[model samples]
Target: MVHGRKFISVLTLTVLVLGPGAWAGTETGMKGALADIPADVMGFVCVPSAKALDEKVNKLMQQLGLAQFMPTSLLTLVKEQTGVGDALDEAGSLALIVYEPASPSPDELHNAAVILLPTANAAQLLESLKAGEETDGVRPLSFFGRDQFAFSKGGHVYIGASKATLKKVAASEKDITSRLDPASLGHLQTLDLAVWVDAQKLVKLVKPFIDQLQEMAKAQAQGSGAGSFTAIQLRSMTRSINMLTEGLESAQIGVSLTPKGLGVSFLMATRAGTKMCELVEASPSTDKSLMVGLPADKFIVAGGQIMQAEATKESITDLDALFEAEELKQHCDVQQLGTIRDSIREMLLALRGASFSISALPESPEGLVGLTVVSKVVDGQKWMDNLAKVVAACKKVTQKEEVAKALELVKHEAGAATVEGTKVDRLSFDLAAFTEMEEKEVEEMKKVLGSDGVSVRLAAASPEHVVITFGGGEARMAEVLKLVKAGGSPLGEDAGIKKVSSSLPGKRYSEVYFAGDRLVALLSSIGKVTGNELPIRMAEVNAPVALVSSSQGPCCQVDVFVPMEMVVAIKDTVMQLMGAMMGGAKQTQDDTL
Candidate 1:
């Protein structure tokens, strides 16, 4: 326990000594210094210049209008204590290398990491540390025991578990020459702060531990009915664990501030010939232009190609087995459940691609938000027939008096609406049909769903494609259906989407986009019902966030980012909220007096 606490404390101290924005660094400055660090370790974090990072980050925060919200007094106090602040000021770079423990014990784990800081004047840095011992900064850290735990040699200060570990790292001659890809090295140099994990090394390191855990789970599942459930869950977890560690090659994540915006990006590469890699490999029908027909006014838009329907169906099947366990089989009809599962599998098999969008249409009569879903199927007519069958099955179950009353609460009316000179099937719902309700509640539902309830419309754009709209009324539905049937300026060409396009992969399995400010406003509009007043009127800007997931053979990459304007909008909202709270507190105090 003592060693564990010491380990955590030392890590916390590193952050304090480096000050704010310490994690942001440039890799160009770390070229020669990388030679001292071992490349075979599980993972490592590198910061090229603490002073430079602090300046860069502060400037970014100031530009984003968030500098005022950050608290830095604790950082100042820690720097004053450790004196490593001055040391880092003259340092070229700082690194923390982590290794797999020989055994999963606190002490062994404690010895499994090392810190290296390369400074111009190692002697001056060492003197400052000695000076801190006379003060409060280095006194509490006496357990590190004199100069043995940390020592300076050849322009680098090494800190480790003990003299033995320190010596080993200091003596290590391995460099990160061919260990990292050139592109990865480029990312390291450019990103503000970056972490790279060698997944292959990680798998080797954790294999023994995983094996032990599996065995323990098996033992626990041996003698009871509940144990069977545990075994099934453990089996699922272990499979996922194995896939991540064994099937992945490497992963890198970094926070960056570009001229356009501040965001974090993640890249992952999977190992060749692995099941996970094969699963992510792109298919022929994977469409990158799926978002083209989506409405530009939407607050949220998500479109994607189904990559692994079989895997999804299999997981659902597992759930079915779980529900059918001996101790819990009476809660549902197993036969009907099986039928539903089969129906869902059939639907999954039929799905080729889908896209959906949500918008808070404040300009509409209802002053509400709504959703629109569009799917490109193999056969639109067949899909609709299957959907009708499912709905009929649902209606059959509502014959019971209680069920009938419950169902009546959502009064459904089947109708037809014209779209692009063609009749489209439609179903509209009156949500509060069976209960006495206030006008305010109806308006509230309108505020959430664009209508008092929902309007589902299905339009067969072609024999092969189907467009569906939910919640938005006739005009909105007609507009969406026209876009699908005839090409127009896509959602991808929208200003918000354009802003983050450069950050997204050229090809992707799926993508999602968010109108940040609109989402904030929508949430704020519903705050009264949740008993909280969200500060939505604080910003007058449209900031968008986008996410894309793609795979190039075995390498699968996902990128999520927002432009810098969104950061500023978020900061402004937070500042206004804080001011309001403070004012309320002051008013309360004055009233007491």
Candidate 2:
């Protein structure tokens, strides 16, 4: 799933992940079921087996603290409603889909469904449903042609929303599979778990709904639950989706358990002609660039590497057209639009490729947090010469008030640092220096202190290279130099990170590393704060949380590596606690009755 829109379909999805045991040790029959589904599905999720998952969940429930009676009661209700009690136990694969809902309010609501099992068991389940054929809302159904097909074909069954847009998938029969092929849906074989999404279909399906939301915003209703979607939020979301789907041609996601932890991967392909793909292709590999000049300490670090040329071009062009739309004319004037367009192009042209990082130092004297957005210029000192003029031209009218206060102070001053035998010049912008003179002096002081006093620290690693740090840190430059000297050995040399990076595309574009011990301690402290009796057992295990991505072909790969041993330990602790609670519950019941 694309993360955002997947959650947006909240009303339609109540997820239950299928287990792996069922998929293993057999040739899956899920393909037969998939054959009956339509092609142009908006959202789809298929899991290996319902039976194995149910077994685990039920055992956990039996051992756990929650009331057992409620689950049983709910199970009975579900059996009655869907008419498939134990049939789920025999399912080869289980899946759900959120497709086109009935008309009127597509943006906020959706319709969904799936009911199936293995061939032998599916017959029994079909019989159960047939027995309740006269049940209200369970009537004879038809697709594009009424009475043209039977509900059960072969050993599988078919059920869909009446208005389901399963566009004539019969022709693509040989190729009618979502990213998760039907035969393999129940099995990733050696892999522990998987998740996939049809990005093209998702984008295709949502575009119309976004347009409708735009129209609704014009009359902009007056309620909260349904029609209350504000234009600003809608516009922003629309733009975001448009931006995301811009270069994207296809997408896939997967989750698998490793010996130490778990690994999750998200992959997306850009259309051949998109600038994003080109940028990805041209991006530098972080593997060789060990020292990015970040702080050498135990901090939660996040960073990215982007080719400026493509990103800037796309952003400027897209945003320019977006604002140029007749609907957004009220927000800006011709002059402002023209200024923004030129600034963006110029900025991108100056920016060759940039890498930036954000970290929570927790224990550092310079500041509790640090942020750096450093862009490499085609000609650093030359660009520095015209920085004020170039940036000043880009400010829209709405932004004037924001920058007016900072405008009074000169933005740049010089400093230098030596990194690995190279002397680097840095331009430091300490906006906090102007805090006392700011109109709202007292308030401005608080804001600056909170925001590291609005400091922008840039280190010119070389004539062509520049590192920009955005917050407070007296030793920030020291950290930057150390980062360059260390060359990010903490991540590049990490075994787990290396493993994950290898699985992804070979061209590493970006990397992030998290201290496992610190994170675990943080979690344990949080539990203590909330008075949670069960402390997370993470401290007992040490593993780095690493994410690295690489560009390959027209697409890129992002892999998240986390230790499975920690996950397993947590599971064991939870189940043990649940068993204790269940025993206590039983004693209480006996005492009561």
Which has the greatest TM-score? Answer: 1
Candidate 1: worst-modelled 10 consecutive residues by lDDT: 134-143
What C-alpha lDDT values do all the predictions have? 0.63, 0.49
User: Which runs of model 1 end up more than 4 angstroms from their true locations?
Assistant: 17-36, 64-81, 84-91, 123-155, 171-173, 181-190, 198-235, 282-289, 298-338, 397-415, 421-423, 427-430, 434-440, 447-452, 523-536
lDDT of 2 by residue, 221-300 (tens): 23322222244445556565665677676565655543344666676766656656676556566555332454444444
Among these predictions, the greatest lDDT belongs to 1
lDDT for residue 392 in candidate 2, whole number 0-100? 49
Query: Residue 348 deviation, candidate 1, in Å?
Result: 1.5
TM-score of every prediction relative to native: 0.82, 0.60
Per-residue CA lDDT of model 1 for 307-417, tens digit only, reads 356555556766756655654334334454455556655666667677778876654554457677777777777776666555544444434576656645543333365
lDDT of 1: 0.63
User: Number of clashes in every candidate structure?
Assistant: 2, 12
CA error at residue 293 for candidate 2, angstroms = 3.5
Question: Candidate 2 local accuracy as lDDT?
Answer: 0.49
What is the number of residue pairs that collide in model 1?
2
